[model samples]
Target: MATTDDSFNGLTEYCDECELDTLHEVSVQIRTESTKKENAQFSREPYRVSECQRCGHRTSQRMNNA
Candidate 1:
């Protein structure tokens, strides 16, 4: 399980209509060689993107993964 500290944290985007910063919750599922000791070729890594519900703004900020 990945913790919030394991993610990069930052503002996902700025809503021009609301004039407020939209916070995003982004998660990246990575498959590494170290993680696949049992099965090296069975890594299903994917990225997750979500926008702020309040502002309806979307952005894939790389900084919000801490």
Candidate 2:
């Protein structure tokens, strides 16, 4: 079997519903938002969203802003 750095290689994460660490499918996404100022400063943020392969629970968090 071949493996890369992604979660496809049987990566496991904590799932709230499952209540135990389980395999999770992870994905990357960008979130766009503007600061609450007169001239709003728009920004694009990256995040890793993961879903438990067994229970369908989601765990998401913003990644380091690059």
Candidate 3:
């Protein structure tokens, strides 16, 4: 089961558009993966986002549950 604190590894939208208050299903992907090295590194995926179908506005923000 997924928990509130569970770090989901997929796309997540957490904000609404100011123009239309429409929710956008932003696309998110794992730009990079963790290595077995001492420290882990993270890379943000490109912002090749799409607009909300209902409002025609871009997503306000993108996030991961993790």
**In candidate 3, where is summed lDDT lowest over 10 consecutive residues?**
1-10
Q: What is the lDDT of candidate 1?
A: 0.48
TM-score of each: 0.28, 0.65, 0.27
How would you encode candidate 1's per-residue C-alpha lDDT over 1-66 as one tens digit per residue?
222333357434455556765555554544333465687666444445455546665543233333
Q: Model 3 compared with the native: what TM-score?
A: 0.27
Best by TM-score: 2
In candidate 2, residue 4 scores what lDDT? 33
Q: What Cα-based lDDT does every candidate model obtain?
A: 0.48, 0.70, 0.42
Give every collision pair in model 2.
none
lDDT of 3 at 45: 37
The residue ranges of model 1 lying beyond 4 angstroms of the native Cα positions read 1-9, 14-21, 30-43, 53-66
Arrange candidates, best lDDT first.
2, 1, 3
- State the lDDT of candidate 2 residue by residue for 1-66, as single tens digits: 112345644567667798787887778898766666654445667888887779888767899855
Off by over 4 Å in 2: 1-10, 35-41
Q: Per-residue alpha-carbon lDDT of model 3 for 1-66, expressed as tens digits?
A: 111322343233332554433334445444443454544454443344545546566642234545
